[model samples]
Target: MADKLDHLLSDYFRGKLDVAIQLRQMELTYRHGTPDENIGGGRKQNDYNNVVESRMIHEQNDPELKRLRYQKSVIKMMFDCLIKSHQDVLIDKYGNKKGWVTIGMDNHIDERTARE
Candidate 1:
């Protein structure tokens, strides 16, 4: 039988990379800023650009980065609680997105064993 925590942790691990990527993209948007150079109006154009840029930098509505960080910390705590073998397998499978075959080869074990 599969433990519920194991399943949740596995899912969390798989999503970790994607969450990190999203956070990075958000940060990049903040750093690079929203370009609105071709605004035909004068003060309105500048105001609009400033508003957009401020919103992006503030990220008031989106707590995704913070949530991802919390999730990552939870995943890390779960990993620390797991046994060495389980930790190795999960880290290889999820962290590096490695296949069972690669994990097996790396660990000097059969692919089937790695899969288990």
Candidate 2:
């Protein structure tokens, strides 16, 4: 019964988080824009130009580059909390832990942004 309740709670939280994430994605997509390829009667041409120009400036600015650096960002802490914290709950629900999968995923993250 405890396991059943835990499963239900996990599902409930996962569903809520997924919905929140989708909503946030919609909001960001609205800003980062569409590949519609038409200026149309939508945002003015200058507004579109500004967004592109802003990105160009960001690409050039040293302070912006430093701020953008994820080098200081630790993905391990995130995985430790999200995956490690939930490992037992997941094993209880699914009967196995993906230890190698987690290790492989960490390897991918390191490979993705490694400056070395």
Candidate 3:
């Protein structure tokens, strides 16, 4: 029962995190722009033109980046409440998307031990 519950919780958190990530990706995509393309070919392109385009890119992406950062911060804070090993396990399993066998190998433990 405990194992099943653990798996269920893992799936729940993974889904939540995935949704947050996908939303961020969509936000970024909607902000889609290519700096060079925007400033098309011109004979007298100067340093200021490049600088302006770079700034524009930063300004455009800032809001989406901030939203994503906040969501990730919230996730990290929640994970921080767990014991160290458990935190590592959850991060490796969900964030890194590793299988139990690979996680165990990376952490130098057996699969069953890693799963437990």
Candidate 4:
């Protein structure tokens, strides 16, 4: 049962990856930021003080430093796939069969622009 569950979960996630699932993950990270990797939310206000103080006092880099960088390209590519998929949405309630941004937009998708 466990193996079967894992397989289903993996398959579901892979299917979502065809479009903007990456974008969704990025947004989730920005809002709640998983404990496993704070990259989900970027840096918080408290982190700034601590990291900056440590850097100045220690005069050395910090682990938080490496995690500070945003995976911009990866995020954008994910958004692009999502945008492309949206183009095929035949209905509102029923969109992508099994799938799922910037300053943090949805690939900066603009329906008014008439492009998905």
**Each prediction's TM-score against the native?**
0.44, 0.23, 0.37, 0.18
Estimate the overall C-alpha local distance difference test score of candidate 1: 0.70
Model 2, position 75, has a per-residue lDDT of 24
- Candidate 1 per-residue C-alpha lDDT over 4-112 given as tens digits, one digit per residue, 9 for 90 to 100: 6555556677675466747665675656655767667655533454756775666644566556556667777877998888788887886677889999999888999
RMSD of each: 7.2, 14.8, 9.8, 16.4
User: What overall lDDT, based on C-alpha atoms, would model 4 receive against the true structure?
Assistant: 0.38
After superposition, the stretches of candidate 3 with alpha carbons farther than 4 Å from their true spots are 1-78
Candidate 2 segments exceeding 4 Å error: 1-13, 31-86, 90-116
| Candidate with the greatest TM-score versus the true structure | 1
| Local distance difference test scores for all models | 0.70, 0.43, 0.68, 0.38
For residues 1-116, could you state the per-residue lDDT of candidate 3 as single tens digits? 97864564465456764575566656544564555554556654454647457655764667755665666677667777888887777778865679999999988889998888
Top candidate by lDDT: 1
Q: Any residue pairs clashing in model 1, and if so which?
A: none
**In candidate 1, which residue ranges exceed 4 Å CA deviation?**
1-62
Q: lDDT tens digits, residues 1-116, model 4?
A: 96754443343334533334344434433453335556666756554536445434432233332222233344345546665445333212123222221211333434543223
The 10-residue segment of model 2 with minimum total lDDT is 67-76
